[model samples]
Target: MSSLRETVPWQEEPDDGTDGPVVPSRDGAAEDIRLFDGAMDPAREEGLLAGLELLGADAARGAQLDFELLRGWQQHVLHTPQPSAFRNLPAFAKKGRERYGIAPDTRARLDACLAESSTAGGRSLPLAARAARACLDVCFFHPFEDGNARSAFLTLLFVLAREGVALNDVGLLRRITFQATDPQDALILARYFDAHLAETRRGAACPGS
Candidate 1:
């Protein structure tokens, strides 16, 4: 059974020497470009669940899991991204390892993001918006190896869940991965996550208020 990290396709085109950053294929289109086979393996799923549990525990303990921790965790999760038939999680991870720069300031940025989601506990719109935005920003910052986006998604989910936001079912996240638009799939994904968080808040508030 292939791992989710192994099964998910990845985009690997070189930057077109453009002034601006190169965006990945948005949404589902990304899937077409990078194809993978295998149903969600139970063992792999269990492992992911276990990892989430650890992250939850760390949050519960009020441990300051900074970018360095995230980087290490991500390194363990994915293979480096490479130009091959199958996406190379390690290569992607290596890219993150290089781009994220081993500086104290980088850690500070990650800390700020974690603090915002964990401590401030702002309003629904702003909180969810920031969570989604942070995911994109972190990815844009290229803070870790191959699974930066995946880590960001997980991180955002943790923040929202901790903040009393009832997130969409896991199915929704799976759907987003399969339906993202081309050339900006990550952005589309961030928007979907934000909207879903807002929707969850509305559903929760309607009965009480």
Candidate 2:
């Protein structure tokens, strides 16, 4: 069966623009920076950062990603820290544009996607492209009951870190959202990753470091 797909209003695609803190330090990378410039919900933002750190540590240690790891990330994002469990019922997602149907084999499917995303240490495609596709996979899968978007964001970071591409600036990555069926979404995201990588390399320092 076809999975859920979401449609969003597209303008000529306007300009894109652009982490951290309250999380335990591990690798001594930058601790905290704003993902967005304006005000944000402090508690939610803190959870996101903590979750990212947890994901980042896994990436740093060369750990393979699976559904259990994803659940761990979700728990951290919610600051709830629960055992692994997929969504038990149909769930509306993507601003309520679509309903994710309950599937009997969702756990196995999500695990397959994670396994497929980790292919060959991402040698088959350019590093950023792998990351973009991984982001889309997590976005479309909608594996958890809550924080799927945050989970997808963490996946992007994990893929990037696996390939040794760290972004001090996340302007393109965080400024927009993606659905599973967004045509050309992967290509557009790859270009954004490329731009972010180029900008980060040119600056020669982490944006907030």
Candidate 3:
């Protein structure tokens, strides 16, 4: 089978034009949901919460996307002393059905793709598309040895947070696995982001009703 890292439909994903140029919305929806997630799994959610905190801090300072930045988040995610480093050898997922082979320049390629996650790279793509793409990047890249799913989730949240778009409900995102090679999956994820954005905006409009 071909490497998922290469087969993933990263470039073909389209932006959901429903919401244009997102403005900052300081809704602590992520925190609330993460708290709920914590109740189910403390150790796992603690790292998620920690990573979220780091994401907020990094967003506040207008930090750029880089491997080290991800490592910082991954360190907390896996409860490791140092930042988690990129895997040097091939990685597999989906019970050995999907393989992510590493090449000599794989790290560099991953870095370049991540850099596009920044707001400056794809100006035309709306917040949802960019955020979804970044999430998928982590998924397909399989950067770390473990906890890549969590890392991908955090990346999605960070992208939305930086753009001031936090979802009131991430139920659609949770427990849903995406395919790397399917363009439809990309569109579906972007639509999920749109749905959450719509709900969050509606809630903001009527806070106590």
Candidate 4:
């Protein structure tokens, strides 16, 4: 199986039990990546980039994970008048050369996971471990009709924020996509989090970093 990072222009189809050809919306992953990298100062950009600013504002409030909060973050990343809601049926993703199957009850499952993970019992897990779990949970659940990648990324930010963690070197995190089912990928993400966290605390920069 090809790794997600090796994929080229992975495509998302209209697979929510709908009856229409997948229209090439202007808001697909490629377009989202362009906005994230090019117009990072959400305050100075419009569309998705501008919405990214709104995402930050909401994050500033605090890191409280729940279905409503996740939906709210989706609202910011997607400013569509009536942004595409949670999948009423099922959703799928093509990562690299492999395809992922999503659960029909993904909505409810995600709600339960978030609810449980927010409590004291959940805090027992290591910080990076918790972050990686949240990250993959969003990835495999495939919550939204679109922008699942962006949503998953934001979920990591929220999970870290709750623990008062921030990383100045997010280059590793932002630029790569991980396989949904690979256990090793989870450990690697934890390492990435630790490395970035260490760099942030030591106040060191790696040339372009």
Candidate 5:
């Protein structure tokens, strides 16, 4: 498995609805998708790279992962049951789109933000704050036909990991997810992630004998 830096390309431009720099054909795509199906196999190592790559691309504004694309990747890798991929953006615009529907405009807004965040420029804040804002924006936008929350969470992890931030506390993230009621709640969660990142960084400092 390649390092996240090595496997994923960092793009400064927005994805223009193309297949991305690393397009997956039927055969190649299947192999890439299979890498992250939640199965306990050596492939997971490779799958993690693939998953990071996808999220990174999304973050970089390299491409959009519609519901179908997300489900296809999930099925190929994890073989999990998911909603139909035929859903379009208008279907996602209704109230509670998080449950069913996605607004096309909102999807574009979120994608643009993801792309901006992926690149290395922005206001300096606690790492967790940035992650929280990014993740919350996606969750609030609920852009995809499905898996908006999952995508937001995964994208947050991928961005932080790329920044060399340690995030070994899945429990904390899960707890925050359950607690978040709105965008503000997500921001609060980001504070926690920032604190965790700071502590981890301190712990990694070399010990002086």
Candidate 6:
């Protein structure tokens, strides 16, 4: 089976010259917590909140992305006393429209891709692109045994928060279903990030309604 990770158009997404606001005024992740809570069972809601708390702390400390870091969060996302482990077999998604094939080096590849989410060494990917790619990476990599969608969402949030950016709203981001093989999906995700970032900046400039 063809891997979704191999087809993502990471290099094709354009960087709009700016990376939105350097600081965000509101907690968009908190908003997501509420939104997720309304849609999920109580245990899942608690897990989401706990995962978000871990994301906030990791972002504050400038922690880089990695399997270990993700596992730390996935424990909360899965509502498990222990961190979730990487999947030992292939994973399917989109009602079987996509298949993420497994390999001996799959976890290593995932780790390498996660590391790219960092802006270190003067990496030029815009904040929006980095976050979008990180989300896609998690979605397609299908790293954990369960809760990969929630994990992807948290990864995106961490990418933005690490750089002092957060959205006041993320409905466009969280509600969409992206295809791994479509290059347009990658660009569209980046555009969504751009939209949210712009709106967050505007809200920050205004302070109060």
Clash numbers, per candidate? 26, 2, 0, 0, 12, 0
Global local distance difference test of model 5:
0.45
List the candidate 1 regions with Cα displacement exceeding 4 Å: 1-43, 71-125, 170-191, 198-209
* lDDT tens digits by residue: candidate 2, 1-209: 12421132222233242111112112212222243421466677677777777887898798887778888878867778575478888777766886666678876776766665564653444566556766776777777787787788888888777656576567677777665566567678877876766666645544344
Per-residue lDDT of model 1, residues 1-209, tens digit only: 01211222222212222211112222222232123111344434443444455556655565554565455445434532421121223232332333333443554555665454444444322443445544554554455534555666556545544543435333344444321113345445545654554454455556334
For TM-score, the strongest prediction is: 6
Off by over 4 Å in 4: 1-36, 39-63, 95-104, 116-119, 204-209
Which order, best to worst by lDDT?
6, 3, 2, 4, 5, 1
Look at candidate 4 and tell me the lDDT of residue 129: 59
**Candidate 4 TM-score, true structure as reference:** 0.67
Which one wins by lDDT: 2 or 3? 3
TM-score, cand. 6 vs. native: 0.91
Give the least accurate 10-residue stretch of model 6, judged by summed lDDT. Answer: 1-10
TM-score of each: 0.49, 0.76, 0.85, 0.67, 0.51, 0.91
lDDT of each: 0.43, 0.64, 0.74, 0.57, 0.45, 0.82
Over the stretch 67-118, how does candidate 4's per-residue lDDT look in tens digits?
5677776775666666457776555667344444455565677776665435
Q: Best by lDDT, which number? A: 6
TM-score computed on alpha carbons, candidate 2: 0.76
Query: Cα lDDT for residue 133, model 4?
Result: 62
lDDT of 5 by residue, 25-61 (tens): 1222223334433344655445444555555554455
Q: Compared to the true structure, candidate 1 yields what TM-score? A: 0.49
3-116 in candidate 3: lDDT tens per residue? 433444545654545453343244444565466667778887788888888988997787877677888999998899988888999999999878888887877777777777
Name the better of 4 and 5 by TM-score.
4
**Between candidates 2 and 6, the lDDT winner:** 6
